[model samples]
Target chain A: MPRSAHRRPAAGRLRGARGLAGWLFVLPALAFYAVFVLRPIALTLQYSLYDWDGIGPSTWVGAANYGKVFTDPDLFDSLVNAFKLIVFFSAIPVVLGLAIAATIRRIAASRLALVARTVLFLPQVIPLVAAGIAWSWLLASTGVINQLLSLVGLGGVTRAWLGDFATALPAVGMIGAWVLLGLCTLLLLAGMSKIDPALYEAARLDGAGPWREFVSITVPSLRQEIAVCVTVTVIAALASFDIIYIATQGGPGNTTMVPGLQIFYLAFSEREVGTASALAVVLMVLVIACALPIQWFAKDGNK
Target chain B: MARRVRPGRSGAALVIAMGTLAAACAAPGSNSPQPQATGTSAVSKAPACGSAPITMNGYFETGFPLPKALTTEFTKQHPNVTWNVREDQFAVITQNAPRVLADNPPDLMRLPQVSELVKDNLLKNLDGYATAFGWDKWPASQLEQLRLGPGGRPRGEGSLYALGLNMSMTGVFYNKKLAAQIGMTTPPATLAELDEVLAKAKNAGITPIVQFNGGATGGLAFPLQSLMAAYGPTGPINDWIFQKPGATIDTPSNQQAVQHLEKWIKAGYFQKDVNAVDYATMMSRFIDGQGLIMFNGDWESGNLDKQMPGNVGFTLMPPAQQGGKRAAMSAPLAFGIAANAKNADCAAFFLNWVATDKRAREIGVEIGGSRPMGPADAYMPEVAADKVTASTLEAGADIAKDNGAMDFIANATGAIYAKSWTPNLQKLVAGKQTAQGLLTAVQADYARQLEGN
Candidate 1:
């Protein structure tokens, strides 16, 4: 018994010694997260409650700020914009990604599939703001896009695409879609690669056709990945700001005034710290509102 | 082998961590944009002509090609001067004033007004330089404006920090050809005259004014300031914005200004979505010649000249209640030295040349692009001709004999105009509320800035 008791400490030490290197390996990452991510999040939550300009002392304001957000028109307009983005990024692109992945996977050369995936994903590599700016010039009032339309004699259709209230929302949302397609295509392609060749062979042996096999085998296998992609894409769509802020600046009236730009206008232009914070909190709440259900599905898919 | 990337229940946790880290690191303002450090070879603080070619640094929004073209002309006259012109957003130069002064400051900046630049004491006193250089060539009105405070500060008594080289008038720019097409003999000379023109234009199916209620650029502030000036004198708006001289909100001019806009709105004097437009889009509409009037600065003349192909015209916007000294916002955009300039004297010499001599006229004609303050018929023949177009250049009288022509930046300059003014007007035009609500919000914003500052 004494020997066994003595062995306990030694055994524990040996086990700990084995894991010690692993713990050390992770410490840098954890420290990085604690410093940048976790700390900033905590600070954001703290600051979101206070009325402070970037300079000078902060004043404490309670839920009164968030309470006011429920009534802000700009907040609601931005939410609608966020919702409008889902059609382009989360719904349509993911389905298209799935199809492209399936088609590319059937190709004999693995390298070609990889190349195709990389090429398809090139848009994601382009800086989104730069892409948005390029698009802005093309879509300007007297730009090439309008010129081309004039060429086709559809001059009436070629209004200032970014400036018009009618088209600004969709035009901005399309940029969000453009940003995500590359990652989606790559991820969906990766998932297709992971589908065991044996399962596909079994489906073929069972006399299943291509569509049947894809639906029965590939679809079930990718459910988890699909869930993940949806969650991520939805989060991304909700968080879209760079494109709108850079291109239109929430113009043609408040038509382009998405929630993100509203936050900026509030903080900078309106200089209402309380209102801006409230709007930010509302944005956070919205992100969570959109994300939580998908998060549940992701968790369930994990199980 | 590197394990495939996964999340949460990840075997390759480091990969996931790195991915997150990369994304987080790549996010907004990750490195936090720092000002580009302009290089400097230190020169004497005291004003003396340098053996090294004086590097005169100036910042303007556009017409960069003009300045580049004038380099040869300037070098011919003063072989020892070279313009190291750094072009960026004017706002960037303003925002970085403290840092620019502390570190390597630009030698000269094309400032909008002396007030904002002078208050911080960033200007070099130009009194001695002007006196020595015999800058008697400047107009009497502009000469009065050149007198700086004790130390070339922007204050009336401040030193002459810089000369007023080029001036852009802010009044009504109307299409005379379009008005003639619509059977109107002349552009509006008064608010009532404007009303009649607006109605006739509306009947003719042209939007009266291209209003960008969304931003502070001449869209909303021009009209709002005009209304305020028209209502009473320009003194109240001045008292509130610059002097803090106890101007009450509830004045007849204030009400009159609000009523004037309301009348215009009821009569459909503006575009359908005036709140929705920006300055660029407004220009597009005006260039298309759909609108009868555009209330912008003198700079728009060059723009209209470039953008509008044929039969375009210009006119100064009439005063709100034009009877007294025809008050318009007479803002003469000027230049100043950085607080900690590496070569203060070189900068001043450059300043003196641009502000005092034939170079002043030449650079004004070339660089300012809108209106040249130097003797007429120099280089920019475009700006020198046409009295209607020239009205904006003429608006910068040293004194406000009446309230109608109060200088927007100096006398009645309101901080709210930069931030709240356009947005408030937009909101009002969007049918959010009355101008009263907008004005109240502006007053509230002023109070906040005052208290917070």
Candidate 2:
């Protein structure tokens, strides 16, 4: 009993030391969040209740700005387009990533797999605006895309791709998919690597085909990466601004006016800080609604 | 190089601290008293920089070649003035004015459109100082045209705030060959004639017009103003801005003007998706000869001529009806000495020299003119080469005095005007919205904004 009591103080001291180190390591990140993230958000919330013009003293307008923004049909247009992109644009990356990851892990051609990953990730490194500029030229009225389509006897499809309302959002989303391809591939490939290969080997030994083994092993193992990819892509999709701005600036008659673009024009162009801040707040609430449930409960769902 | 000091305005420009009493300085009186505003002969020697160069900050307009060329000439004349120019695509000047005024606003700057500054009390009155400098000789019409104060009243009603660099006149740029190809003897001079041309152009597999209406609805207002001049009466445009007696946007003339724009859109005279083309793309397509005609201003001539590989020509914007009096929108544009400027003397001297001296004429001709105000003498000599631009400027001078030229922010086009008329104008042209439907909505929005303001 005396020896047990003597050991207790040492254990308490060890726990205290670990806790101190953990905080010390995270201190820089915590400081960054306070300065860049928390502070701006707090300031934005305050501004949302005013009729400020990005200058001069703000006048309290109660909830007037919020009411106008919510009732505006233009804001509704942007929100609907954002969801459409998540289903159409964001899903492409997940499917493509899975296929590429499977091929890389199964092919046994290490050099080819390494080269493919490197090339795919190159688009990720291109500055978003520069990348959008490149796409704009490609999809221009007389650019390479039309030329290729013409060769296939699809000349009827030719038009200003980004200028057309029906095709603008889809075309922009496709570019997003192309840009994120590398990041998705790398994440899924990482998950594939972590799955014990012996499970695959055992399945093969029992005369299970490739499809059966992949479903039992790879799919179950990749649930985490899929969640990560969806969450990240959805966030990126919702926050899409630079590409859209540089390309169209939300035109073809407001068809491309995503919420982010709306927020930018409201804050910077029209100088409607109250409305823009409210939009930002609205966006945060939407993102949390979309991402929280899946992350909170589904992290351990796959078994 | 050596620093040069302007004799006349240096004292006024001294950057006294906000705490210092302004009582010692007398407020300058009305500048519209008698002689040339700024002239080379007006340059005097005496005041020099106290210690460091006088610093000037401004929201600079003009892009690429023009800006580069002008800055070179301006810098060569004044070595003591260290200027920092910031470029903005839109009304960045208006947005930045309060910050600049509250926390060390630039000693000198350009505001794209003025009323916002004047309304906010951010500008300085250049009355007595400007008058002493011979700027007072400017005609009564010229002072009123500058709208130095609110309600579109005379500069005499309040303090002089800003001056424009040059005025812009929106005109149509057409392919000389295309007009000839359509077998039209000459370009249309009236709205009905222009319509016939559009119909004929469409029949010939050519787009009738190319516009940046999609890029910014500012262009949309150009045609509307032209219509008021040609189809109905200019009284509504001039007097309605100040809530003056006589006319309003709700008047019959304005409704007719709106109907005319709707007709053009519904008829597909311009491109179908008008909103898709930004200013650059819109002008470039016209310059490329994709469309037979386009509507813009004189400043665009320099821009379009370069983009056009072959040939380009200009004419006054056609009137809305046949045989309508060809009225043109006119306003004042000139340079002014800043009230709080450290080198007020230098700024005044530079502006004065640019206004009247022979050297001013030389510089002004090479560039578009510094004085876009509507007067025969106000034009830069280069306009003499283009008969169309020359005549338009002449016409602009005739009506430049109408209702004191410049309009206010709340009156010209407010948020309601934008929401109701501008966007729907495109849909109307696309044949989606009926003319009456669009105009009714626009009138409602305009009234709402007027009430709110």
Candidate 3:
């Protein structure tokens, strides 16, 4: 009885030592996360409660900066624009990714399929800033798109796609779609490869056509991947800065302004650090509010 | 299960520890005035740099070769002095200036907007250096824009905080070949005559004026400000820009200027894709002979001399009526010393050399493509009469005679250019906004920014 009791304490000590070792192993990563991520978030929250020009005196103006974020037309309009971008950045890419993944599955053994995947994924390899610049050139009034339209006897419709008010937002959205489509397609393709072939065979035996098999077997099986794509792309659309900054800089009368760019201008250009921090905090909440639902839906689907 | 719970407890402890560290690092209110550094009086009165080797740190605007060229020449002439320079785009400099000036303050920095910095006590007051170096003897208008009154309100009236490397003036640059093709033998002398030339160029199927309205740089503001100078006296405009009490940009004369710019837009004189063209693309298109005229500053004089040679001509934007007093957007390429600079004497000496030295003045003309700001009798560099630089220099004299120099509207506030003017001008080009709406929107934004300040 004494031996067993002594052994119990020894085992407990062993377990405690193991725990300490595990924590030691994670210390570096934890330190980085604390310094880079958590600290900035906490600082942002603190800054949101004050009025600062980043260098001069700061005044406590609790909630006034947040009030401006909701009441200011420019700030509010940027949020609306980001939400609208989700249609192009998230919806179109996801839908197209499903279609492309299905088609690639049919030709999985062919060499053409390899080339197709590579070509479609090419945009993902290019830097977003470079892609934006190349796209701007292609969309300019005297660019290849207009030249092609002229050649097709549709010259009357040629205008600067990125410089027109009605078209600028859609144009920027299309660029986002172009950049994100490749990522989505590859992710969904990977998920499709993991789906049980028996499920597809069963659907086929039920007299289901290619479309029915895809609807009944493929999509249901790839819910997790679709959820991931929506979450990532929605975040990308919301946090977008580099592409829009390079292409339009929130111009053509602020048609393409997003919260990310607006926050940048408020902080750096306007020197309104408190308002910028407030907007940043709001953006973080928005991202979380959007991501949580998708994550829950994906997790709930597993049950 | 016990192990997992232990990690969770440790994670919570780690977060608490991090929160405390961040709270400790959070800065307290920084409004308390710093102690004034002494020994500046002695340095300001020094006639020449000491023989000891000195490294002057500088921050300059990228894409402008003049600053770099001048620095290199200064180092060569004064063998004891060297430089460590950093360059960034003008927009980036504007965004980074406050932080850069406060921490890691460069000995000399390109200051695009000075009032806010002076208000924050980030810039060294140059009044003592001005008196010591006899800068007060120079043309009053030359140093006018560099001075700021109390509280940094009403610029042009108080202690000087910066000095110009050279005087820069904005005017209309025309393609001589395109002008002749449009039946123009000389530069236009009146607003009506300019309109006739623009109409003629349009009828001849040439882009009349290729102004950039794209992205962030909004080149449209150039012609818009020029038009403002043409339609009205420059005093009220300066008053508005200098932030005089009760000053407003919504004045009737300025409204007339906006209307005139709108008329030009409606005439399709600009390229259909003007709003899509960036600054670099506009310069390239103009250099390729795609446009008859472009509104630009004298800083491009040397560049045009190399690329298009004698095929280009420059003239001040003509007045509203024949023989009316002309005005132009004229300001210095201003540089200032940081409040915490370690080498104030060396920097002041360099500024004086850039103005008074004969070789330095030549570099200012031949390299900077702008007139050096010095005494009224300072040495003038010789350029061939037919060179574009010569015409720009002559226009400088005309602007001086008219006492019609004005600062760029973009410099009115640090954020006004990016937040208000660029967007409004882009809307104007897109046909989504009216002239009056543009003015009103900009004025409202200006008021809001000032209130925040």
Which number leads on DockQ? 3
lDDT of 1 by residue, B1-453 (tens): 233323433435555455554543322222322322222323233566557766666554454354454445667776887777766655444444434543556766665444434433555555555555454455434444444443222233334556654554566777767788678776566777878888888888888787675423326667766666655666555445443435555466686787678778778787755654667778778877778887777655555656663445555456555544455665456666765565667655655555445655555653454455443333434444454334444443322223233456323222345445544565566566586676677666556554543
Worst 10 residues of 3 chain B by lDDT: B31-40
Between the candidate structures 2 and 3, which one is better when assessed by lDDT? Answer: 3
Ranking by DockQ: 3, 1, 2
- Chain B in candidate 1 has what TM-score? 0.75
Interface RMSD values for all candidates? 8.7, 15.2, 2.5
Native contact fraction, candidates in order: 0.05, 0.11, 0.56
Model 3 lDDT tens row, A155-251: 9999999988888899999999999999999999999999999988888888899999988889999999999999999999989898899999998
Backbone clash count for every predicted candidate, in the order shown? 23, 21, 0
Off by over 4 Å in 2: A1-32, A108-115, A205-214, B1-53, B62-71, B91-97, B127-130, B133-159, B215-221, B238-259, B262-268, B272-274, B304-310, B329-349, B369-422, B442-453
Please report how far candidate 2 places residue B449 from its true position, in Å: 5.4
Tens digits of lDDT, candidate 3, B278-385: 899999999999999999999999999999999999999999989998999999999999888888778888999999999999999998889899998888999999
Q: Against the true structure, what is every candidate's RMSD?
A: 9.1, 11.5, 2.9
Error of 1 at B1 (Å): 13
Best prediction by TM-score: 3
TM-score against native, each model: 0.69, 0.80, 0.96
